[model samples]
Target: MDHIRRLLGRVTAAALTLLGVSVLIFAALRAMPGSYTELVLGPLATPEQKASAAASFGLDRPVAEQYGHWLRNTVTGDFGTSLVTRSPVASEFADRLPVTVTLTVLALALTLLIGVPLGVYTATRAGGGRGGAAGRLLSAFGMSLPEFVLGSLVVFLFTRYRLGLSVGTYTPWSEGPLASAGSLFLPACVLAVFCTAATARTTRDAVLGVLVEPHIAAAVARGEPKGFIVRHHVLRNASVPVLTLVATLSAYLLGGAVIVERLFDVPGLGSYLVDGLDRRDYAVVQAGVLLAATVFITANLLVDLLSGLLDPRLATAAKGAA
Candidate 1:
């Protein structure tokens, strides 16, 4: 009963959050200077032409009515047609979302693959050592470098050295998984840089904290195998905090992907959103923002559920609150 109640509460909250985001997205876009009709018709268009266009687009309706209509259509999975392209926004998103998802997944996998191991090594060698110093230095450098700068550097180096790697080209999954991964690998690395550094630092701290706990010392005293202790005791206990950081960073990757996608010329939702904004396509922008928010909210909710599973105390606390 408590779990059911908690789940209901989470669902309710998520729905409300999405509603608020939709309101903000609608209002902000409306508040922006200029109208889609004007952009479409040009300054040479007469007042009668503008009025007809506004009416056709339903922009002549009251703000509340416009919002209500948009909300209703969106509830029915009709995200409306793009103002610029005259194509269904939902179809556009459907086409591009997979690209973004693939990129994000690749970047996250790289982050975990590199970050977790480096963190474990650094934590074990926390006491002054060349290895620890080098790890720390690397993390610091990664955190300091901006994604754009790093991406540009990679592009420049690849071009200058004739590395023969595909930099700004995207390959569809229809070709092959390996080709798709290869095309996205460089951009994924760019997206992963800062996240990897942050994850490593976070993991190092969590592991270090867990390492000093009494249970760890007791396990060591009992002559438990080093690998067994580290795996069952250290990593297990440190996972909660690391998991939370990973969830947060994963959500952040969505936003960061916008810039990275542009740099790589990937046909992702990020690039779609950029094109929408550039052309002031309200439907496209609104759909993109709403989808991004939904994904973020959903990820956080999943993380919370997973965290509860990982730490029984959290579930107990939630039950008590329920």
Candidate 2:
């Protein structure tokens, strides 16, 4: 029952956060200087034409009424038509969302695979050894490089070396899964570098904190194998903070995907959002922002629940409160 209540509360909070995001996005777009009317009809459009365009787009309605209408339609699964493309916003999202998701997921996988082991190795050798120093230096270097710079470097290296890798091109799944993965691999690596550095540092700190606990010393004195002790005791306790950091970083990955997508010419939601902003396509931009917020919120909620599962004290506290 406590778990159920906690889950319900999280879902409610996520819904409320998404609602706030929608409101902010709508109001911010409206608050911006100039009019979508001018962008759509051009500067030379007559006053009568602009007025007609505004009315047709429902721009003449009161701000509150417009928001209310948008909110209601959104609740009913209607995201409206794009002013520039005349396509349904939902359809546009459907086409582009998977690409962004794939990039984020791929980046996260690489981060975990590379960062967790590096962190563990560094933590185990934390006492001023050369290995520890090298790991720390590498993490610092990875974290210092900006995503665009890293991306450009990767592209230049791959192209300059003629490494037989495609750059600045997106291959759809219909072409072949291998080709699609190949196309995204470089960008995913670019996105993962910073996340990997951050994750490695976080994991190292968490592990180091766990390493000094009395139980760890007891296990070590009891003649337990180093690998077994670290695996069963060190990692299990250290996972909570690492999980939290990963959850927070997922949002960063999504946001970074925008610039990476543009740089690599990937036709993902980030690029779609950019195009929408450039053309003043409010519907596309609104829907894109809301969808991204929804994904981030949902991911965080799941991570919170998972964290509770991993740390029984959380569930115990919730039950006691209930």
Candidate 3:
């Protein structure tokens, strides 16, 4: 009951959060100084032409009324025509969102495969071993580098060696799965590096904390087998935190993919976002912001619900706090 209640509360909160974001974005964009009509329709456009353009897009209305129309239309999958491209924003998003989704999914998979086991290895050997030492250094190293610089370096290395990276092309899975993978793999690695480091460090710390508990030490002194100890206690207890870290890192993957996508020349939402903002394409910018906010809140809500379900202690804590 508590879990369901918490989930319901968060879901409701997420909806409100998204609404607030859309309103804020609308206010901020509309609040910018200068005549939006002049900007969109061009400075040289006559008063008649500018008024017609504003009226056509319903921008001639009061801000609140315009926002109301936006809310209604956005809910129904109509983002309106782009001011710059004069294209339907829905069509633009349909072409772009999937590419980003695929890229982030690949990066996250790589993060888990790299971080989890290495973290376990370091935690299991924290007393003193090369695994702990090396993992610590590597994680620190990854954290130190900027993501764009890292992407650039990867591009340089891969392209210099003619490693079949093919940085300037985006192939869809429908075309050829292997070709698509090859195209995205390098950029995904560039994006995944920080997530990998963070997850490893977080996992290592969680496991180390678990390993130091009196019960864990007691089991160790009682001649418990290493695999048995790890499976039964270390992983079972430590996994809650590891799961939380992974969920948190997912946001970073989404945000970082923009720069990586730009570097790789991939036709994803990130590039669309950058281009829209640069050109002041209102529909594209609005759609990008709403889509990103939705993804972020939804991911976080799922993470919280899953955490609550997987960890009985969280329920107990909530009850106590109540």
> TM-score of predicted model 1?
0.94
| TM-score versus the correct structure, for each prediction | 0.94, 0.95, 0.91
Model 3 per-residue lDDT tens digits across residues 1-322: 8667766887899999999999998887776665557766678889999899788877788988888888999999899888877899999888887788778888889989998888888888788978789999988988788989998888788778887667778898789877887788888888788888887888899889889889899999999999899888888678877777776666555543678888888888888887777666677788888878887887777776666667678778877886
Per-residue lDDT tens digits of candidate 2, residues 289-321?
A: 887787678778877778777878877886788
Expressed as tens digits, the lDDT of each residue in 186-231 for candidate 1 is 8999999998999899889998998999999999999999889988
Question: Scored by CA lDDT, what does every candidate get?
Answer: 0.86, 0.86, 0.81
Worst 10 residues of 2 by lDDT: 248-257
Q: Give me the runs in candidate 3 sitting further than 4 Å from their true place.
A: 33-42
Residue pairs with backbone atoms closer than 3 Å in model 1 (clashes): none
